[model samples]
Target chain A: MLVDRLNSTARRVPTWIVYAGLSLPAPWLFWQGLTGGLGVEPIKALEHEYGLLALQLLIAGLCVTPLRRFAGVNLLRFRRGLGLMAFFYLCCHLLVWLVLDVQILAQVWADILKRPYITVGMAGFLLLVPLALTSTDRAIRRMGMRWRQLHWLVYPAVLLGGLHFVMLRKGWQLEPLVYLGLVAILLLLRLAPRRKRVAAHA
Target chain B: GTALVGLAGAGEAQEALEPNGWDEITSYCNYYEFGTNKDDPSRYAGQLTTDPWSVTIDGLVERPGEYSFADIIAKMTIEERIYRFRCVEAWSMVVPWNGFELADLLDLAGVTSDARYVAFETAYRPEEMPGLRFPVIDWPYVEGLRLDEALHPLTIMATGIHGRPIPNQNGAPLRLVVPWKYGFKSIKSVVRITLTDKEPPTAWNKANPREYGFYSNVNPTVDHPRWSQASERRIGAGLFARREPTLMFNGYEAEVASLYEGMDLRANF
Candidate 1:
């Protein structure tokens, strides 16, 4: 009954509201970084915050299908917005690393090539590029079934994102490992078979 | 060459040096005994009991015994030393440390002729330190330096910062300050100083040898495997502040470069 109620309420809410609400944190975080609210090392803190938000958004995107399949919650309309927002945050994370953290242009390229964690993170960001480009309604209708196949790239993209966080930490830190573990569990949930609908004749 | 000349006039260089604010020095720390976060030590280190402390000076020392913190302070002549503190994470700070040369303490203990290395151990109190609950890099953090490096005039055992007793978060009672090496090499809340022949295993090096070498001298050329050591961000520098190029031996090349003379720094690194 709660799931049904949630679904009914969800239909009345404009999907743009979710986009507007989620986008609020980005500017607020930037303002915090500017105002010294991010502490002495604001750049590092800002970079970390953006990366964390991006990972969280990716994990949230992974939850949509399972929620619809099991809980009977129809959040399909907001899935695109979630995916796009995750991409947006991922861009912010990458930009912060590039423009603010490692300012040297050659060094940035060197890092992406040399560092395994950066390589994995860059690969994850690259995977989302096509998916984001094709997120439009026209592109979705035009491509049809192929669109669904293309969007499945999110699975590996999110896994790599989680892996990046794990590798970036100094030692076997709990927080990053927990994020990676949560991503593993959510991904495993996707593998479970969907329940067969009962036949009307039967 | 210019930097070397600047450092040659050590007294004048020190006068020109501006130590970081007390807030920055005390708050931003990597005392993993307390916690890993920069502010974790400040938040959780209050639980630590630092008074009435004693250090055990053992392994090839004539006066090898538990020396009370007060006795050590009374025996030695305390002086202020302004040094550049460089972390392996590529951040740096200028700290004005109040302590005597480590050689003075070693002299008090009377180092044996065969002692090749000086290994230091941090205080291991699980009841006081929450971070110790997790097996983060094998608890009871240990670090070591060659006997000569330990005896170096630049090497000091700091008791206070900014002309006041050190805050618990910043290794309250006693801590090593090796200006030339990475900050982690300077062990914190030191309880034991053992002079040994064999090279003692260090905490970070033991954690990841590929990334953290035993001789983690602040050399910009020898980058950490995970990240570049080419440039460092000053801790209190503003958000838009440009990263300054990291100097050889963290701008203490003139003072410490000869210690590693013939040895290959890149290989050791």
Candidate 2:
């Protein structure tokens, strides 16, 4: 019954409202960074917050298919918005690290090349660029089956994002490991056998 | 060298020092005994019991016994030394510490001729330290220094900061402050000091040997595996403040460079 109620509510809520709601934290976090609300090292805190938000959005986007199949709560319309927002947050995360944290242009390249975690994070960001570019309804209709195939890149991109977080920490910390575990479970849910639809003619 | 003399004199010169704010120094800490978060120490360190503290002095020393904090303080002359505090994570602060030189304490203990190293250990009360429950590091947090380094004039055992008694989060009763080395080398809330012949295990080195080395001197040229050591962010330096270029031996090269003479710093680091 709760699932039914959630489905009904989801239908009435415009997808644009979801975009508007999720985007509110972006400006708020920027304000926090400027006003010392993020403590003494606001740049580092802001970078972490943005990266974490991107990962969370990616995980939420992953859940759409599973929720629809298992609980019949269709959120197909919101999937593109969720994905695009995740990419937007990911760009914010990268920009913070580039422009604010590591200001030196040469050092940034050095980190991307030498640091394994940075390399993995950069790869994930690169993977999402094409997805973000092809997210429009017109582009989806133009490509059709190819667009579906292209969007599957999100699975590996999100996996790398989780791994990047796990490696970023000093040691085997529980928080990053928990994020990686959640991503793995969501990806696994896709492997379950699909229910066969009954044919009326047959 | 003349530069060495000038720098040594500068330590005692009555120059107006710009130390970080008390709140910044007290709140932003890396005392992992409380928790991993920067504010964790400020939040949870209140539970630590610091009064009536005693330090166990043992190993190749003439005076090897449990010395009360009050007795140690009474025997030593306290002074203020403003020094640059640099963390291995590429952040730094200027701290005005109140304490006597560690060399004076070593002199009181009378280190034996064969003693080559000095080892220190932090208080390990599991009931008081919640962070100890997780094996973030090998517990009882240990650190060590060469006998010469331990006796360096710049190395001090700090009891207070900014003319007041240190907060529980900032190693209340006693802590080591080796200005030239990384901040982790300055073990906090020390309870044991041992004079030994061999190099003792340090917490960060044991946690990840590749990243942390025994010497851990603040060298700009040598980079940590994950990050650069060339520049450091100054805490409380505002959101848009540019990072300052880190100095070799944290600008104490005049006094400390001789300690590592004829040795390769990059290899040692």
Candidate 3:
């Protein structure tokens, strides 16, 4: 019966399950850092690790559709889990700042206002808040076509987020630019000729 | 007064340590390196060396002696003075600093007539302080104060906060705490104090003079090149809460506003 269950959907890409499996390490690592089970300065490393993971997950979430379309695989399943992981990491990033770093709302707000990168980063996070809030199947179904429209905000959010990292640097560097390029490509995908035709048809 | 630490029995000796209005003052920080993210310092600050820290007071001062953070702390009385800390970037945090006034230390050092300004420098360790690896700003972080600015009644060479010892992340042992100026003006983890006649160049000013000036007083009217400084979100308050108006000198106007009366604050800023 198990083999039959596996065989029935064997050809289908279990992308969501794969993404969920991939996200397991991120939270486990973050939890370890939060609980002081890790090495010296666990909270410190956790902050960076989670933030980087969040960005990487966002990048991977974007890549899922492209990879699936290009590689001829049914990978829509993975997109949800990977995208949710991005949301999860973003939450952890916020938590590290809220709980361990600033620990105060006023200071956090002040920091968001005082620093440009912080402001942009926070704006990016703010944009994600609504998207994450409505990411569920129920909400997506309820919202209908608006859901896809709203999800488009992620394009700018990720772009701004990449810009936030670059601005934080004292001088222009290559790493942040690479992230920016990924965001650009992700956005460029939206501008594909097929996207235009699809929108026209809709 | 190291003995003041032992004076635990004394209660309500001073004003209650009021929060300056940050939504989360407990986590508000001034560590410039570690990427300027509010939580970045929590990760990178552990690498900083706070023990056996000393400041060499030289230049125009007659008593140019190296004072260990221990000697500096024990000698002065600890007071819980909540200060409004405004960063040059435009955010503000009201911190309950624990240390005596800078006047106490200045009097001990005995500044000479030639002393026009006091310059502060942080330890230059590129290896441990990870932010130093990239020249985010000029190395050996610097800050300066006019003689009057240094002697402001509220200025304190802060050693602690929230009625307890300062955590290493928040400039432990010794740091210049100037509530009236931007947060960076309150140089942290101080290593050198030089009294010089020439106006000293600060870290930010050296990195980008237009953005940072020597007399970086907390000003709401003057906008930083990148952003506005008209208001601030008080840390420790709930998220999305109403904000308060930033004061001329962090609401210490009664004591410090007069000091900058004649000077062109716009130019100075």
Candidate 4:
């Protein structure tokens, strides 16, 4: 019944509208920032805030399937959109860090090598690239069942992301702990049942 | 001097931690978006228009008025003071500041009898400031000190660094430079200075009170919420871990420690 409702809604909502609604927020946020609506130093804040939002979206994208089974919110199809948005923000985040933060090529690569957290963060961000590239309908059809297997990289991407946050923290703090807990619960919910089924069959 | 450093020749440049001195501090910086990094501020923030920037002096003042940055710079003679800036995050830098005494500015403002503390506020335009959205610190960045602390000779409002006007990324136009406290205590891109009877909530302290205290004096004893406050990575120096013994009161023990006499620095810190 929920799927039927979602299908009907999806049919009624034009794809262009969906795309427009999805893509408008970032540029709009950036524009509002340029106009000084956000506060002093709009561009810097816009970039950082969007980057944080992107990380949050990556976690949310991973949670969609688990949420559909557990929380009864079957917004699973939105995962692709959310995932794409995450990659978009990651691109922007990387660009800003490179352009504004590093401002030099030699130091940019040096920072990635020298800082452990940056290394993990870059790993997390880079892992999303293949997933984003193979997200298209044609790519999904071409890869067949392997498409699902390939996309499993999202799990490690999210894991590395949480590790990035933890490693950046010098001491135990509740924020990173919260992200870690959510990831653990997500993995357990998806994998623990499969393990139990295999054991029962044996 | 040994009582401060425990070494007879502690002030003498010693064979060191990571080798290269004057290397990292110039390169790595957390100046947010408004100020230039230690090295790039002069290059990038050079074109910043500070002549039109006005500072509003209000709060517990008998006479409140607006003063342009240029006028303020012209009113007082800037003296060169080489001071150590210890960050709350456990990094330290020895910067030579060209600044005027805060006492001169406070006197010009005619601070009232009720004014017991001086609060500073940064420009809140995110369009210009870009980093305001998620300031590794907080919005409307602030710093303050008790009236006595404000009146201290070492509490100066810096206009330039390294004998030239401060670069944009280094809080161009005007900023506070309190040698006795961690570097964050020196507020940047200031637009407002309010004299208040009650202590103002500072940016770092409001973000994490346990880590950032009201009196962020440089005492080797009080550790930050994350790292050791006893010592710091002197940036632009060789090696990642190279460090030197931190001074008590940031080497301003004689100039400023009397204000906290009989008070436990550990508790106050």
Candidate whose TM-score is highest: 1
lDDT of 2 by residue, B51-150 (tens): 9899999999999999999999999999998988999889999898999989898888899999999999999999999888877778889999999999
Of the two candidates 1 and 3, the one with more favorable lDDT, higher being better, is: 1
Candidate 4 local lDDT, B13-88, one digit each (tens): 2222222222233344455544423333334444556667989999888779898887787789888766677776
Give each model's whole-structure lDDT: 0.89, 0.90, 0.72, 0.71
How many collisions between residues are there in candidate 2?
A: 0
Q: Candidate 2 on A1-202: residue-level lDDT in tens? A: 9888988899998999769988998899999989999898888888999999999999999999999998898888898888988898998999988998889999999999988899999999999999999988899999999999999999999999999998887756667889999999999999876556434334
Model 3 is docked with a DockQ of 0.08
Worst 10 residues of 1 chain B by lDDT: B1-10
Order of quality (lDDT): 2, 1, 3, 4
Model 4 chain B poorest ten-residue lDDT run: B13-22
Each candidate's number of clashing pairs is 0, 0, 34, 24
Ranked candidates, highest DockQ first: 1, 2, 3, 4
Runs with alpha carbons beyond 4 Å of true place in candidate 1: A195-202, B1-8
The top-ranked prediction according to lDDT is 2
List residue ranges in candidate 2 displaced over 4 A.
A195-202, B1-17
Question: Just chain B of model 3: what TM-score?
Answer: 0.88
* Candidate 3 per-residue C-alpha lDDT over B1-269 given as tens digits, one digit per residue, 9 for 90 to 100: 42343123112322543555222443456565654555567667787777878888888876889987778777888877766677664456657777887878877788999889989998777776766666567678889998887876677877766666666567766788887788888887888988999999898888878788888777878877665566665444332234456777666555666668798888988
lDDT of 4 at B149: 89
TM-score for all models, in order of appearance: 0.96, 0.94, 0.64, 0.57
How should the candidates be ordered by TM-score, best one leading?
Answer: 1, 2, 3, 4
